[model samples]
Target: MLDFAIFAVTFVIILVGAVLYLYPSSRRASGVPGLYPTDEKDGNLQDIVNKGSLHEFLVGLHQEFGSVASFWFGGRPVVSLGSVNHLQQHINPNHTTDSFETMLKSLLGYQSGMGGGANESVMRKKLYESAISNSLKNNFSTILQVVEELVGKWSSFPEAQHIPLCSHMLGLALKTVTQLGLGERFRDDAKVISFRKNHDAIWSEVGKGYMDGSLEKSSSRKAHYETALSEMESMLLSVAKERKAQRKQSVFVDALLQSSLTERQIMEDCMVFTLAGCVITANLCIWAVHFLSTSEEAQDNLYQELQDVLGSDPVSLDKIPHLRYCQQVLNETVRTAKLTPVAARLQEVEGKVDQHVIPKETLVIYALGVVLQDADTWSAPYRFDPARFEEDSARKSFCLLGFSGNQTCPELRFAYTVATVLVSTLVRRLKLHQLQGQVAEVRSELVSSPKEETWITVSRRS
Candidate 1:
């Protein structure tokens, strides 16, 4: 009994030692000069290590560390840059060091395979670009259809009943993106609905897993990850097979089919594309509605703009360009409520930004949430002022990282169109009301969204 007790004590000691060894340690010894010097008050390494909220913690760190601060996240050296010029230098398409597909693989749960190879990466970029160009040509009618359907359904819902705006937007986004990408509506079909539910569940679970690092350690997390991958592959395989049988060409699906990609690669690309569209589009729609509901003046101004431009006619693709205030409102929403609050990339090769030396293979995160809201860049950063985008004085301060220009998110054009249609259609027909005394709360995971089950009351505008 004494011998067993001794062994147990030794085992506990060893376990504690192992944990201490693994715990993230401060590594500020490098003393790398940053674009903005780190504030001594904000340099509490223990606070950073203890804070589990990635986005909030990062924002706080940036507040102290300046735009190009260096810090450690779980033994990984992360160089954070928030300056627009720095982002332009590093994240552009011509920048050979940035590996978008590799970053995407980490997010999408795909095994990083040969870094998508340089030639293949370029090809993928071209394919994405072509897909966007083609989607612009083909997706207008499909977007209008989705918007019309959403408006029709909301109008039919019993008046003054608080509608789950977030979920509804999510469902509508799923249907809209699927129709555009796969040429099929998956919202009502039982099999498709099940797939979407599973897909969303997987993302939610896996996002938790990634943030906590439980995905690597927990068996249940592994199972969830595998289940998500398997279910996604199964769904996509069925879709691909059907497309093959029908011999129909879809811009998204066909791009995958024709590529020399393995089955897993095709599945990863399809799932990421679909999921990205759904989350961003849905969140954008919800925020737009939320803003319009709270600001009667903004809504009235938008209604007038729509009336003059659309004038009881269905919002055509051609007229979208003329809806200037509508565009400004969406831009303001993006600025205030950034959908993708943070973006990360790894430095493949050593690079220098002024006096700061970023080593090769360093992880760099551009914290857009902080940067966009920074007082240095925006006046009245907290206010939801769409007019800021109207004046040249205010417009110069606006650096929306959504597309980020050179390394533009490929789907921005498509997402903008869908959001425009939805907003224009709804405001043209309905009077959106904020549930009395119910405030909308923002939720952040892999992407930022309104709290699930956000309720809004909608009535037809008389």
Candidate 2:
């Protein structure tokens, strides 16, 4: 008992000391009026690590501190930029390179090293982006085929059935990204299952290393983590080798194989997208379904738009542009759900926001949830209204954050195309409704999604 108590006290003292040591440099501006506010009341670290998820905590911080604030994350202080002007100042200039890679490494508790620099990654990045664009533009048959399979399975379910959307969407995203990223080799059921199992082992640890350090401290988890990574790397390398020897049909991996990047680099890139492409895309699809399920009017409007653009036919690439209302539903879903609630930039040099001076090497974050629901930018900010996007002005407000025209990532674009197809196909034939006596509470993991299984009953449209 005495030993355990001593350890606990030591841990708390170390934690407090670390927070004090790395507290923002502006802490010294005791009498200065220009520095951003801090949570000296010891609520700072708690807010960032709150179980309600970082998004909810950030919303509270922004509400209390206004446009700019600072909070402690362990020994590091993260500066939150909450306004449209503040967010634009960093993102608009695009000072950060490899933003996605930086986020991934930070979560994994790893550092960027040689051969992974900005310039070295440019060629591989272009190749991967071009492959996705070309595939979506010229070769969309794979996506259509996958959607057909998904619809057939859903139709086979009993009438007015309750479906667990998050699981199903994840499965759909896995099949879609795999077929696109790895090619037909993944179409093999066994191979897909093997890859998913290894992927899940790694994904289960996301955003955890930064807190518990389990990936490093726990021997069991460390071993499991290494095993999973090794299996995935071996799988990617084997496929890359086989494809290079045969010069088989073009795929994302094939494109990467021909690049000058090392095998390890290619493996890392695939791993990044494998985790990213699956979760975010799946969440977007599931959230849109949940929102539409609650609002019959939105469903009706979306169905009508679909019928006008693609009546009794599978969705095609050329038909995507004409489905304006469908696009609105998606845009509104991303905004309401706040799919990606935060983005960060590292300060290589000191910077200023308004009158405050930011110190060097600070991690500046864009609290996207706060901006997405800003009352000044979004009308009745919390209401889930698709009509808000009917005009070009709403999109111009910079409130859509990650889903906006200028802000989308490659995986987001791919997911949008997939999700638009899924929603269009299902909404035309069925009406989605939330299961009685049950509500889907948001679970803020690496991706924000339902805490419990998201159950939506689908009934055939009369």
Candidate 3:
């Protein structure tokens, strides 16, 4: 017993010494400024994980640590910023390609050295000039067709059958975006349906793994993510191959194939474009409906605006601009429920932000959710007021970075048109109800959603 006790005591002492030696004691030692507070004395990696929501915790960190602060994310030195001014200073078109490409590669699971920088640039330029540039104008008919199909489906739902608004909206958005990008309807098609089911399942698991800190070094999670991404790529590549064989040049796949890019690169860009547009636009529609339902006055006013402008003419593409109130409502929805809450960049060269010197290759994260909701920039930041965007004074700051500016995703114009049409169609014909026990909660990931299960009641407008 004495020998065992002695061994145990010595082991405990060695463990303590190791921890003390390994743990960072000061901000400078941690490669961060001293202004930011660290819980190094009491906190561990598990403590960081236990904090409520990752998004909320990150926001709090930025609040406590000013615009530029550092935190240890799984042993990585994560530099965070929450000001638009700071983001604008760091992320410009000239310096954003590396960070953007890194994220794209990670998301698409692309192999390095497969495509050179010059080829990637040429492909990006072709994608921008061809598919993205023509998306808004070219996809108008497709958007309308998708919206009409969705409206027709919703019109059949009786008053007793309260539709799951978010799911339906997501389905509609996914279908519309896929149809627009691929020039084929894949929403309910058997192969596409299975692909979506598997893709969503994998992403859900991956999200859980990330939040639980199990994604890092977890071979199972890594395999799951890779499989999901691979399946998505395979589906897209098959479609691209078919389109090529047919000499079809209607959608993004066609443009991608024609560009100076490999099949893998084309697949990556397609996946990014499709996923970005589908998720954000769908969530926006869901939130817009929720806001309109909760606020009767706003809904009535919006319905009146739609009626006055559209007047039962099925919301023509040309008439989208006239529905000013609908646009404001959409903008307010984006401001309140930021779809893309955080934007990240890596510093390429040493630069000074405010008084601090930021080193090269340092990861910088800008909290768009915090900045958009900052009281200094917005009045009654928590309120759902669409009228704030009606006046010219308020309109100047209306750019909420939904699609961002310098590193703006190419699909914004297409998303805007599709969202405008869908919202206008619904508001004109339907009166939505806030279902019992339905409350809006933000779900954070690559994009945001209204909690896990958000349901709203809809009835045809009299």
In terms of TM-score, the best-performing candidate is: 2
Stretches off by above 4 angstroms in model 1 are 1-29, 33-52, 85-101, 107-116, 185-188, 210-213, 216-218, 259-263, 393-406
**Poorest stretch of ten by lDDT in candidate 3:** 1-10
- Cα TM-score per model: 0.83, 0.86, 0.82
* Candidate number that wins on lDDT, 1 or 2: 2
Q: Which ten residues in a row have the lowest lDDT in candidate 1?
A: 1-10
| Candidate 1 TM-score, C-alpha based | 0.83
Residue pairs whose backbone atoms clash in candidate 2: none
Candidate 2 regions with alpha-carbon error over 4 angstroms: 1-43, 91-96, 106-118, 215-217, 399-402
Worst 10 residues of 2 by lDDT: 1-10
lDDT winner between 2 and 3, please give it: 2
lDDT per model, in order?
0.63, 0.68, 0.62
RMSD of 2: 7.5
Clashes of each: 0, 0, 0
Ranking by lDDT: 2, 1, 3
The runs of at least 3 residues in candidate 3 whose Cα sits more than 4 Å from the true structure, single-residue gaps closed, are: 1-47, 74-76, 88-101, 112-115, 122-129, 133-136, 185-188, 205-227, 391-394, 398-407
Candidate 3 residue lDDT tens string, 221-265: 678777777778788889888888988767777877776677876
